[model samples]
Structures are given as C-alpha cells and as structure tokens.
Target: MAIFKHLRVSDGVAAQGDGKLPAGDPDPPPAADGAHGPPVTNEPGSTKAWTWRGDFGASLVVVLIAVPLSLGIAVASDAPLVAGLISAVVGGIVGGLIGGSAVQVSGPAAGLTVIVAGLVQTYGWAATCAIVAAAGVLQLVLGLSRVARAALAVSPAVIHGMLAGVGVVIALSQLHIVLGGTPQSSALDNLVELPGQLASNHTLTVATGLLTLAVLIAWPRLPQRVRVVPAPLAAIAAGTGVAAVLGWDVARVDLPSDPLAALAAPQWPDASWTSVAGAVIAVALVASVESLLCAVAMDRLHDGPRVNLDRELTGQGAANLTAGLLGGLPIAGVVVRSTANAKAGARSRRATVMHGVWVLVLALVAAPAIELIPLGALAALLVAIGVQMVNLSHLRGVHRHGELPVYLLTMAGVVALGLFEGVLIGLGCALLLTIRRLASIAVRVTPQHGGPVRVAVDGSLTFLSVPALLRALTAVPEKAVVDLSLNIDFMDHAGVTAIDDWRTGYERSGGTVRIDEVREHWYAPGRSGLPRPVRRTPPVRNRAAWHPLAATLSGRRQLEEGTEEYQSHVAPLVRPLFSELAHGQRPTHLFITCADSRLVPNMITSSGPGDLFTVRNVGNLVPRHGEADPNDSTIAAIEYALAVLPIKTITVCGHSACGAMDALLTPERAGNMPYLSGWLRHGSHSLDRLATRPDGPDRLDRLGRENVLQQLDNLRTHPAVAAREAAGELELCGGYFEIAEGRLHILSPAARVPV
Candidate 1:
C-alpha cells in the first residue's frame, strides 16, 4: 500500500493506440493553448457558478453522438434496442453525479461488443445482465480499494491485440445481419456461410447496408455546420430514408411503443462456477480498463478538473450496476462522446448528467422513430467499426516493436475461435517476446584488418541461441584462426556441448578455433571439451566465510603468481554476481585497506562490487578533518567516496603482514626513501601504542588491531564523516585481517576475539 501511494495519473495519450474510440472517429480536436484557461475562469478548485446554458448545449452534442452508438453496440450485443438507451441514460445520470472526470461521457463502448455478445449467447440476454451486475460489483471493490490505477498497467500489446480481435469477430458475425440473415452459432460458422450468403439474391438489405456504411464514411468531411450531427446519426438517418423509399422487406429494429415494456429482470447464471467467474472477471477488467483509458484521454482535451482515476472507476461501476438491473448492456466511459463533450466546452459533469436526461426523454418521445431504424443499417455501422479496428497505423506501430505476429495471430484466432481464446493467444505471444528480449543473445563476427573473424557472443548463451551460434561458426572460412570471445553470463550443458562439439569439428576440418572468455570461462586451458572442475568450499568448524589462504591453497596457482588464487577460485565464486557491474559499481561502504598482497579483504569479509567503495594504500588512513592536501591521494579518495556514493559505512581494515606498519614500527626506517618514510608518518600513533602492549613478542599482531582503531579515529576528523556520524546516518567501523592465521577480528576500542 505504501509503495503505490505515489501512483502516477497519466493523460494516457498513448492509450489512443489501444483504440478506445468508435471506428473511424478522428482524434479529438485539440483546444487552443489556454483558450479556456485562467482568463476564462479561476483555478481548478474555483467555486464560481457555471454556465448551465453552455453545459446544456454541449449535452445535446454528446447525446446526438451517444444515441446511435449505444443502439449499434446493443444490437451487436444481441440485446433489445432499448437496452442500449437504458445504459446511455444510467451512465449519463449516475456516472455524471459521481465520476472523477468532469467532461467524459459514460455509455456503452465499442470495446465490449464481442464480450457482451458472447455472454448473451451463453446465458441468454437476461442472465447476461446478471453477469454485468456481478462485474459491476467487482469494479466497485477495485475502485474502493484504490487499485483501479493498476489496471492501466495491462500491456498495450495485449489490449490492442484484444480490440483488433474483437473487431474482426464483430465484423464477421455482423456481416451476416448486413446480408439479410441471422447470425450463425459461432464466428467460424458465420465465416463458412458468408460465401453462400454473398451468392444469394439478398439485394434490398445489402443496398441499405452499403448506403449506411457510405454515409458514415462521408459525413465527417462535409460542411462545418452540417457536421454538428455525429456521423453515426447522419448515416442511420440516410439509411432509414433509403429503406423507406425502396419499400424493401428488410429486418428492422422493433422496439415496444411504450418504453416501459423494455424492462427485464436479471436471471441467475446457469453454468459452472469457473465459467461464471471467467465471465464476471472478463467484463469487469475490460470495462474498467477501457473506461479509465477514455477518462484519461478526455482530461487531455479539457482544461477543467483532471480525472481522479479511482472515482471514475467507482462511477462506472454504479452506472453498470444500474444498467444491468434495468435490462441494459454494460456501460463505460465512451471516448467518442467524452472527446465531443470537451470540444463543446461543457462546464461541468452537469453536461453528462443532462445528456442522460436527453436520452431518457428521447426514448419515450421518439420510440416510433427509433422503431423505424433498420437492423441492417446498425449492422453496417458495426461493420465499419470492426473494419476500423484492424488499424493499419496501429499495425505499423506494433510491427516496428516486433509485435505484428501477436496482432495478426490474435485477429485470426478471434475470427476462427472466440474472444478469450484469441486474447490469451496474443498475450502468450507478447509474453514470449518479452522473455526473448530479456534472455536475448547477440552473436557478432567482425572481420579484422588481416586476421580472422572476431566472434563475440554477449548475454546468456543458452540452448535457445545454439542454432545461431552454430550457423555463425559454420560460416567461418577453412584454415582460419577463429578468435572466439564469449562475454556471456551463463552457459548450460547443452550450450557447452554444442560449442565444444563445433570447436573440435572445426579444428579437425583444417581450421584453428581459439576460444577466449571475458566474463565466462567455457572450459579449462588444456581441457577444451568439458567445463573446468571447481573446488567448492567445504564445511568449516565455525561456518565462517571463505578463508583467503584456503582458497589460495586449494587450487593449482596460475602462471601469474599474484592473481592465481583469485582467477582460479575466488573469481569464479563471485563473477556471476558482479560480471554485470563490469560497467560500474554502486557500493555503499568505502573499505580502506592496505595494499599488502596477502591481505585480501574481499576473501575475508565476503564482500563484492556494489557492496563496498574501497581505497587501498600503504597505511589505511584519513589525513585531516577539514583540510585537503593535493598530494594526499588517500584523502582525495575518501572525499570522493563520501561525496559521490551512498556510503553509510567507512571501514579501515589493517592486517598483520603490513609492510607500512613494519616501516613505522622499525628503528631503521626507509632512510634512503624519504617519500615512503613520510607516508608511514600517518601511522605514527599506532606505532607508539604498540610498544605499550603487555604482550611483548605478539605486539606486531597487536599493532595491526591498534592500527585499525587509530584509522577509525582519523576518519571522524574528516568533516563529511563527522557530520554524517553526528546525524546517525554514517557508521565508522574498525577491523583487522590476521594474515598468518587466516582469520578476521573486529576492534571497537581494543582488539577482541575473531568475529
């Protein structure tokens, strides 16, 4: 809950890519910069009375657009014509009263057409209403929980693929109605009968449908004043005229003369719990996502109050609950009406409430006129909407991101199978794409000036990428030295065997295959086929961290003496965790240690990159508190580490075999080397304390522990460390590494037992 407190409220401008609008509706016109801003009104929370006249006028504009779309969506959903109007009325009144978005119009949306249709087919129209009611309950729960914003995180690829699939299915099934025939049992059935329907003489309904489709396409490009009537309304009116003039026997919408007769009670779903749950979740999630997306788009076109996403979700739920109970299709924030409302300059949510009032008034007053509208005309409208869903622009965009296959597969699946199946397939494909990208391997071969090709493989070279690797290897010219460089993080058994087999085969074919590794060691130097055997740490008496001496002794040392232990043992144990940081480190502790070879702090302390900000020198020391000496590199590293990193802990780790300590403790110092003698001066206090130790012979070991405590005291003198320690944000710890015994001990005030 705390993590989500700062959840972002985006304008969802890119959500238009999700196709929230009715097919073919141009993007909402943008308002002039500050046209309705400050000079026209006060800031967002202003209490000035709004212009009711302006709101009412704008309500009429949205009502004109919502009526035809609602009717068409209901028809596509296989519900009575009045069900669409009921949804429009309830969405306007209930949602407007409580919605977060002031200008967004709430009604039946194109996105839910296929979902509603399927519900109607499975459980009948009355039971489908119950499903809508159940979905509304879910939406209410999500909104109240304040998790509604999280729904917007659904991948754009899945959403677009889903809508495109819905569009294809809607077109195929509704094409049957446009051709003067009832819809088939399934999309596949409809597709099979489509050719036969085309061959028959269904002339009049086809003519009406074609004219309706034509008007919808042409109406928007007409003269400015005439365009006030929405394209859907204009197209429907023209189609009605054409049908009446021809005296054709076409399937027409038959609504009761008295609108009250449209009311129907919800029926309990007669199905298994799993199916019912699926239906409820589907409607709730899809409606919530689409509504929220529309609300965000509406906020962009208006200068009024921005949409409070949770409240918008709650409002949609209330409207859907009301619509479902009243025998209506489920409702959401309709983008077409929402965008139109903003463009018309509606002052408040009053415009949306009034639009609902208009729809209710129209249903009673205009029942006879509504009954005259032909089903073919509505089907034709749906056809255009569906066809628009197979968007070329959206396709091109998805293709650029390599998601074209997802879109195509989804669209095909919907047409061939069903809505949920198509969506699942598309989501599966998108998931695969994401996984491939995350686990992607890059195999490159650069032809050198005079040498053979330099083959480098980056990322996790697992079995999935073996085919490509083999092809690249096969392309190498014969009798050539292949400089193979593997900058990979992981290589499984299959990958290792494939590469090994290829290398041997290539070398046997008169070619020299030289294998080199940057991050991963494929195999040992002499043994080329198998992975190098490693000596894993054995159980210790105290179960402590890996001892540096043990690590150094277990493995055969490398040809290079100093790095032998690390390269063969320590490096392998740590490379997997730190190889990604080959780029950089973001350590929190600045571990200042001596440069003595045997004193391996990482091996003793069990630390890696990003765990520590380290500075090693002759004597692990901090020079002065508030002053910077240009010659002191130790002081400069301290300052840089403290300032640049999120360093909370500063550790000065001193050791037993420290040459710098010996130089300081000895009577005969490096008299010939003045620079070294001067550098040893920083540890003078630790040397003076060593002589006072009661243990005479073991004073050298005691000096190591005392030296760490002295460095810790020196660290506090720095202004940066002092300030942070005072604020209780930074910690200064004293520690020493016992080289001969291969153990570590902590020194708070004095050296204690091994820690």
Candidate 2:
C-alpha cells in the first residue's frame, strides 16, 4: 500500500506566494519526498502536512460503493461486465496518481451511458474502444494547450439539461430489464413497449426489484451507526439473498472465469472516417465536461487541496487512454464515489489510487461470489439514480435566471435527437436571448405644439438601436426646438455618428437642439472634438459660480441657476433613491446643532437624502423635558423622533467662532434684539459650567466645548431617552468643528475639554 502511495506525480504543482503550503493542500515537489507530516488545521488560508492514514480509511469506504455502481454502468452500456471494473481501476490508479483534484474519485459514470450505448451499437465494441482512445489523445492536447478553464464558460443550464436528458434515457431503457423484458434501442421505443412489458407477469423478478429499491430508499433514513455500510451495497446484498433463498429462475451477473485474461482489445472500425471522427469528438467533449463539473462540485465538500483543473484534465486523458486500450468503458469523475471519499475523511490522492487497487484485486479474486448477484437488482439501483438527475432546485434556479427556454430546448433536443445536436440548439437559444436584451433600447418622444420637444434615450446605444433613435427624432416638426437628454449607460461609434448626423441635418432646417448627458459623457466629447472618449468618465461639476462675482449676477440668481442645473443634469440619476424615500424617512441618527448659516449638518456629517433627522435651534440646546413652553417645536421634534423613527444615536455638534456663544457672553449685544435675547436664556447652564472649568486657548472655544457637553446632559432629561440609554440601546456623542483649521474633536464626559 505504501509503495503505491508514492506514485502521486507533481505535474502542475507550484508553491504559493505566502512561503507556506496551504493546510491539507497537496502540491508535492518532484521527488515525492517530504510529502507526509503531522496534519493540523491552522488559521484560514494556512497550510498543513499531508497524512496517509485518512487516505487509507477513505479508500475502503469508496471502494465498497464503487464495485456495485461500476458493474451496473457497464451493464447499462451493453458492454462486458468486466469492462466496468477495468475502467474503475484505470480511473483511480492513473487518474488519481496525476489528476488535479486531491479527493475527487473517477470511475464509469451513469451520465455517459446513453452515449456509450450508441457508440457500441454504431461501431462494434472493439471499434468503440479505439474511438475512446482517440478522444483521450484529443483531451491530452487540450489540457497541454491550457484551454481547460475555457470549458467552464459553457452555460450551467445547458450542462444540467444534458445530464437530465441522459438520466431519463438510462432509466427508460433499464426499466425493461428490471421488468424481465428486453429493452429497445432508443428511449421512444422503450416507452412505446413499456405498457405491454408491464402487462406481462413476472412476479419473482418484480419482487426482487421492489425489494432492492425499498432498501435503497430506507437505508439513508436509518440510524447513523447502521448506515456506515453504504446504501447501494446493502440494497444489492438483500435482493441477492432473497433471490437465492426462493430458488427463483432469474437472469444474473455473468463474469469470465479469469477476468484479467478475458479483457478486450481496441480495433479500428470499418466505417466512414467522418462518422468515426464525430464519435471521437462527442466522447471527448462529454467525458471532459462531466469530469470537470464533478471536480468543481467535489471541491466544496473538503477543506483539503483545491483542484488544479488543467492538471486534472491531463490526468483524466491518460486514464481514458489506458482504459480504452485495455477494452474498458469510457471513464469520468463519478460524484457518488468522490462524495463518499470526501465524507470518509480522505486527505490525499493516495485514497483515490488505493480504491482502484481494491477494485482490481476484487475482480481478479472474487469472480464466483459476484456471479451470484441478480441483474435485476443492478437495474433497479440504476432506476433510482436516473430519477435523481432531474433536480427541482436546479429547475428553480434556471427559471430565476431567465434561462428556462434554453434549458427546456436543450433537454428536448437531447431526448428527441442526440447530445451534440441538443447542445447546439441550447447555445443558439442563449445567443439570441443575449442579442435581444442588448438591442432593446428605450426611446421616448414627448412633443409639445409650441414648446420644445423632449426626447429621452436610455439603455445601451449601439448600431442596433440607431434606427429607433432616428425615427423618434423625425417626429419633431422642422424648425422646432428640441431637448435631447441622453442618459445612455453605454455607446458605440455608430450610435454617436447617427446622433451627430441627425443633429446637423435638423439644425440646418432651422431647429434648435440642446444636449444634456446625465452621468456618462459618451456624446459630448465626440461633438467637441476632444479626442473621442474610449472610457465612460463622469462629467465633472464646475463650482466656480458657487460664490458668484458681483459683476456676474446677484446671489439669488446664482441659487436659481443652480436649481436649473440640478433639474437638467442630476435629477434623473438620483430619482430612483428619492422615489423609495418618498414613502417615509427611516433615519438612524437625531442631530442637534446650532442655527448658524455656516454649519451645514449634511455636508459635515457626509450624509445625503433622509439619512439624518435634524433639529436646529438657538445655542444648539436641548431643553430639559418640561422647562420650555408646552408648544415648543424643538421638544415636539425630539418626542416625535423617539416615538416614530428608528433613532439609534443622538449627536450634538458645536463649532468655533459661534455667534450664539458670543451672544451668551455679552448680554448687551442682544439687549435690543427681543427674539435673540429670549433664545439666549437656554445658554444659562453652559455659562455656569464655563466659570467652573476655564482651561482653554480662548473664551469662545472653551464655551463651545462646554455647550456641547451641557446639551448631551440635558437630552437625558427625556423619559424615553433616559430609559433607552440606561438599557444601552441608545448612544450620545459630542463633537466640535473648528472653522479655521477644519478639524473635528470628539468629547467624552470624563474630559471637560475637547481632545
């Protein structure tokens, strides 16, 4: 066992960048030395040493399940029973020793049964083997050329549909054998003959088949300890025992006296070269796809090494070549055996090779015992496997992604025509769907009799949509005004040329046209001759007029112009978010700040559109629960915040050079201003604290920090605020922003001064 374990070759392995091996991730160097060590699972993305103990135990579990499944798949393909065991051995020994994935087990999968059966019928058994060998050579070339990853680009819907179609064909044909009747060649023929086969009486065979299926279904639901024996093995054993005890006359599995000596050899077919080449390509593509898909699925089952896909493809090619020359069925990575190996704690490739060794040994020594098992039992087992292929969860996912049409057409093509034809149909459907979606651009023309006509274009603007744009433009009357707002997310040269030509021709006829690009500038750059933009860069907003010059216009005119700019350029882009917020506001923070013109809460906090619930009053004050007038709007706002919105944090922000704080210090400043003096009374608490703690660079700065702290204390006076704070559900924070330096300081209760 240990001698065979050293045969794992380092073909595509390379050390990762972190200077440490990934835990249980095998990337052995060329001499195969230092491969074994103490296994440990460290932090995420860390490496551990490989262990043989896990591999040895996992091989036993996988081999037990592989033996029965291998024989059944070969029987379904209408080939010699020994061919199944031969493929099993080659898939494990050659495939595992060099394959990319650490734990995925390869064998004769049920997915290729229909293809193999067709090959055997068209080109004799020996000639089919020769075709398989040729396909293996093609796969080797593909792997070496590093095109293995490109196969994954095929849609998963097409792949799933192909498997489901194959499963249906296998189940239909295998059902005939379970019912003690000969199966017809195609799936349709089998269905047409099923009713008559069911009418004929075959009580003993039916009993044996029912017993096998019952055990297969019931084994999984049993206690965990009893299920240590694999379900397939247990199900077959029970059915065979009953048949022998009843002394029923039934067809049973037949094997040569010496299985190794009776192995078939490949031979060239005497058919057309074109037909043979098609067979080879079909076999190569289907087997490659099945094995690659299985390797990806098995990777999610273990925390061991990630599969090296290109290396795995090369290994599978070598295995298929060996299996074909030795007169075996085509091989692929089998999910059942691979899943068993992973669940049984397999850690390395040693388990995969050892399972093959076990199968080879059993075929050489256990010929007589295997012959005792009935063929009906294997057929019954296959029926269950076939039914499971049409998965409901996969159907739902296909529907959700809008690929149901492709999936259904592929499955129908495979069942009615063949696998290759079905795949071509599916690919065609997917291409048409993609082209339709890309060309479906939106062009709306809103015409006004005496005013400027509005034309809005959305979606990708390509050559396909150029006609639609021109038709909408022709609707506007000659010598009329037009506003063409292009909110295009993507565009090509043809689309740009179409729009430019239309605008030039229309303006020559005495029409006015204005263009506004909302987000991406795909048109303006080309029209201005500023080196046609290849990338969709955002249009920068010019803020030169934010503080307009006296010669330019008054401040009121500047504000009105800003509003017009927002409506023409920014409104369409932000409309989606604003539409959702129109229903209600769900602000998470309640912000209390001074009513100073310089303090913009949204800009300072970096929030936009219904993020902050703000309350601005004189002194940035939050009066104690009942101190102010009963009709106070500030108190009412706080009560509404606590009662309605999901407010989690309450922030009080104070700033430097505050006019309110200066007013608080000098009563004479506000002596004549009645409203200003009345609002200054709220700063009395902040004034008392200023005298107790006077350590600052300036009186105004010191008063600002004290006011922020005093307001936080006053907020706790509310019953809801006090209760939520005591329970640790709500938080209170203080911040002070300096105007000159543009810096913010966070204040805590322990420190009277800002830090």
Candidate 3:
C-alpha cells in the first residue's frame, strides 16, 4: 500500500523511509532529469529532474517578446525601463519560489499600466512604492490566512466577461501604436484621438502591422509540428524585421543616455498618513484583482487543482515590495507569461524561476542588444499582445446568453469612464436585471386541482403590482367560488388597498371571496373598521369563532356572535331597529357594513340579517376577485346572498368615528399603525363621499354617511350589480354609523334618517 504524502505531486504516493523531501520545500524535483532533485522524506523516493531542454526553444521565443513588452509597459506606466526588467525577474524568481501554482509566471502586467500611471500622477513614485510594499504585506497576510478563496466567489460569468472586456480595451488601445502612431496616455484621450490618428497615419507601417496580424491568425492552421511556435511571437518577429530592414520612419522608443546608470534603488517617499493609506488601498485592490484572476485561470487549466490564492497573492506582494525597493514598478501575476509558461511544459516552480533567471542573464549580458530593438517594433508587439487578449468570442457568448445590455453597458461604461467605475455600473445593471427577472412572473391566485383556489404570490407586492391584481381579478369566472389567500410576508399599502377594492368589486360581480388568516397590524390589531372615535378593547382569546367576526368589527365587541356580552349589550338595541327590516318587502336589499361594532347595519337600516341581508368586513372592502384565495369565502357568501338571493338593494354602511375612517384621514396614524394603515386605504372614497354631503352632525358622521353613499355608488359599478340594476332589479343605499349614540343614520336624498 502506498503511504500518502503531501510532498509528492501525484496523489497516493508513499514517502521514502529516510527524512529527505519535506513539505514547504521550495526546491522540488523536476519530473524528467534526476540531477539536483530534492530528496523526498515523506513520499516514496522518486528521482525526477524537471527538463528545460524541451522548452528551451519556446523560452527563447518568449524572451524575445517579453523583452520588448517589458520596456513598452514600463514606458506606458511612466516608469524607468529597468523597472519592468526588475519586475519580470523578481516575479519569476521570488514569486515562483513562494507561489501556489507551479507553472504561473509573474511580471509587470499591462493591465497595471493605467493604475500605475494614475498613482504616479497623484502620489509621488516614492509613496506608490511604499504602498506597494504595504500591499505585498497584505497579500502575505491574506495567503497565510487563506483569504484568497474569496476571489473564487466571484461569478464565473462576471469574471470571464470582465476578462473579455479588458481584452477589448487592450486591443483597441494598441491599434494606434501598431500603426506607428503615438499612444495617448489616458484611455479617454486615446479613444477620442483614434479615428484621427488612423486617418493621418495610414502608412506602410499600418499595412505591415495588418499583415503581421494575418500571419498570426493563420499560424495555428499550419502543420502540427510547425504549430509549436506561438503565433504572436512569429508575427512580432516578422513585423519588426520588415519594419527595421525597410527603415520605416515609425515612432520608436529612443533609448536614454546611460541606461545602466538608471537602474538604482527607488527613493522612499515621505510616508504621510493620507498618502500611505491611499496607496495601500489602491495597490491592494489592483494586485488582488490581477493575482486572483491568474490563479483562477491556472486552476481551470490544472483540472481543478486547489490553488493557494492567498499564497499567490503573498508572492505577488513580496515581488512588488522587492520591485519597489529596487526602483522598479509594482508587479503581479501576468496571464500572458503564465500561459506561456504552462504551454511550454513547465512541470514545477523551477520553470518560473528559470524564466526569471533568463530575464536577468539577458538584461546583464544583452543590455546593449536590447537597445537596438526599436520602440515601434516593441509597440507593435504590445499591440499584438493586447489584440490577443481581446475575447470577441466571450462577448458573443454574453450576447447569446441574453445579457447584451450588461455586455454593452459594461463595455460602454469602461470605455467612457474607467475600469473601477464601469464595473460598479455594470454591477448595478446586473442587480436590476436580476430583480426584473424575478418580478416578471405574476403571482397567480387560482383554484388548485380539486381543491380551494389558492393565490400564490412569491415576491414583494407593492403599488406597482396594482394593475396585475386588477387584471387578475377581472379575469376570474364570475360564477366560480374563490379562496383568496395572500401568502406574502411583505405587502405594501397600495397592495392592500388594491385587495380591498378587488374584494368589493368581486362581491358585487356575483363571486364568492374569503380571507384566510391575516396577520394583525401592530398599531391596529383588530379587524379594519369604519372611521370612528371609539375606545378599542383587546381582542378576544377564542379566535376560531370570534376572530373572523371581530376582525370584521375592527375590535368593537358589541356585535360578537355566541357571546352573552354581545347579547346583553347589543341585542336589545338591534331587535327594535330590525323589526322594520323583517316586514320591509321581503328584504330585497343587502348592505355590506364595516366591521366596526358601533356601525351596526341593523341600527342604521332598522333591519335584521333576515331583513337587510348584511355582510360585514373590516373597512367594508370590496377587493378585486382572485387577488387572494383567502378572500374567496367572503366574496362567495356576498355573491350568493346578492345574486343568488337576488337582493334588490345593496348598501355599504360606513360609520362616523370609525377606526378605518380615522386611519385613512390621518396618514401619519396609519404609518404608526401599519396593518390598519394599509387596510384603511380601501376607505379613501369616504372623503369624496363626505365632500358631496352637506355639513351636518359631526364631520366624521357626515363623512361616514357620505362615504357609505360613495361606496354604494362604487358598488353600482360592479358588473353584476350594474347588470342587475340595468335590469331594474337592484338599487343602492348609503348609511352613516354614529358610535356615541349607538345609532345609524341612513343617507336619503332629502335628509338623514334614523331608520
């Protein structure tokens, strides 16, 4: 059986009997040659030396490209050319020694050009270096704490799309340089001058650059053996050689006098409180973004090998800190070089270190030869690199996924503003798109198969949802029984009001409605009642029988069913008033009254349930049908009583000094009392009704009666009621409830009457 050891690169490998290779050893064995292999103490001794010969050819080609790129990026970032070389060396050597991914190469990345330039312009170079040191420390801490996992939490789509966007930006910016035109320092300036730059500089240099691009595109299609050479390198070599031999008068990097003397330690800046703080934040963010992105790419390429992102970040930070101290710019994990290393058969961190060694050796030995390379040629190389980074395929994928708006908006924002701000805007758009997708589906309230109609609203319902409710209610079959249930935790006032209106309308249209368990509002705990000035009592304990009735009464216990208190307190008064209702032409009228106990329809109409055929609910609401299935019972009962029983007159009695009415009158009070405030909006018509009535009694009383009258008018608008009324069989009446005197006054054309 193989003894599993962490030191072995492959899983399930046994450790050697002797203490040799240990975990965390930076120098590990190469997978090919046995020379200079680190001995394995824990894992079975496997003598394998990492081969560099196979990659020598590829590495040579990469160095050609890397040299030019390093200089160009340094120039772009407003840093000394040696800074780029230092970064490349440190990134490869120090980063490779500590980084989690074996094949990833670290260097001064082009993506940092914009950030470094900005930092230099804002804070002096010294401060930026200090910040870079701090950022390195932060990355080290992050790696030790394993905080790099957070980078993986970003959505795959977002990361890919971001990379694609970055690619496009890079490609566009390089176009000017490729055509032998001077590049603008700022992204905005470059974009603004692109067309004019192209128009003015349409020279042979442009043709040569395009031809180079074409050759790069066709290189992969060449024979399999020939395909080993990367397209970009070949393209650069061809383009640069042609331009040089032809002596094209194109823009080129002019080597400074005493290039070797420029490679000195960077001066440390005065670390002020503000400058340090700003630089640290900027460096941390930029480095984190770049390093984590490279780590993720390497992870995918490794077939899901866990990447120590924090370790990678720490390596990056360390590199940056060293680079800053050595008078070099900040550095990060560069995708181009990392990819190149991976493709070149790098088996361990040795390849990265070797790449750094190569850069250092070349810098020391071939410094003069590097000066011979033209800036325009390097610019063309950079242009090629930038073009390769642009991922048009990813953009197409985003469009295909129906996230075109996100793609376009993000691209536009990045192009117009800058990277960070553009990403923020894109995030906002993405959130909005998510909400819209969630909101698109309507909350359906309908009967379940062989069960009561269930109204299912999965999301938030607000004023904006009113039209949906209205449309839904109007679509229900007028004759079918409905069980309206509002199973939502959050419902706004407009939604509640819409529900009330629907209830009233559904009942009037000869449909049944029922309201299931409705959570009580904190301020207004009882059922929704008429606007009135009355003392409120705590709700009764037994809810099954009385809760529904009590909710309809808005906490006034005077009209409770099966209660000795109600019989003693309210029966005597109602019996006398209802005597006239008993003999009033077979009770051809049904009045739906507010649940407020003080506004008893019997007292107002001088009728019993048999005489007036009354139905009561909190706020005397007529909510739209099918808004919720809980309302089905209430609606069905009303429809059965009005349409089946075929009542001639339907009245909605509102009372003065009513809770619902008062709640509606003062919005602040409603705010203080949420549930009641939401329910009270149903009674807004009371204000209109009161306005139409002449001043009489207390204003609340007048308004209460007027509101009842207005509700009567609203009831007439119901399809069933309108049809019945048009047939000369139905009529509407309005009445006001007086809580103080325990009296109900009906509103007649001539005068108010205590029926």
Model 1 misplaced regions, further than 4 Å: 1-36, 39-54, 245-249, 443-755
Better of 2 and 3 by TM-score: 2
Compute each candidate's TM-score over C-alphas. 0.57, 0.71, 0.53
Candidate 3: residue 135 Cα off by (Å): 3.0
Q: Could you give the C-alpha RMSD of every candidate to the true structure, in order shown? A: 14.2, 9.6, 26.5
TM-score of predicted model 3?
0.53
Residue 560 displacement in candidate 3 (angstroms): 47
Cα lDDT of all candidates, in order?
Answer: 0.75, 0.79, 0.60
Q: Tens-digit lDDT track for model 2 on 94-143?
A: 99998999888888888788888898998879998998888888888888
Shift of residue 658 alpha carbon in model 3, Å: 70
Instruction: Kindly indicate the candidate among 1 and 2 with the higher lDDT.
Output: 2
Ranking by lDDT: 2, 1, 3
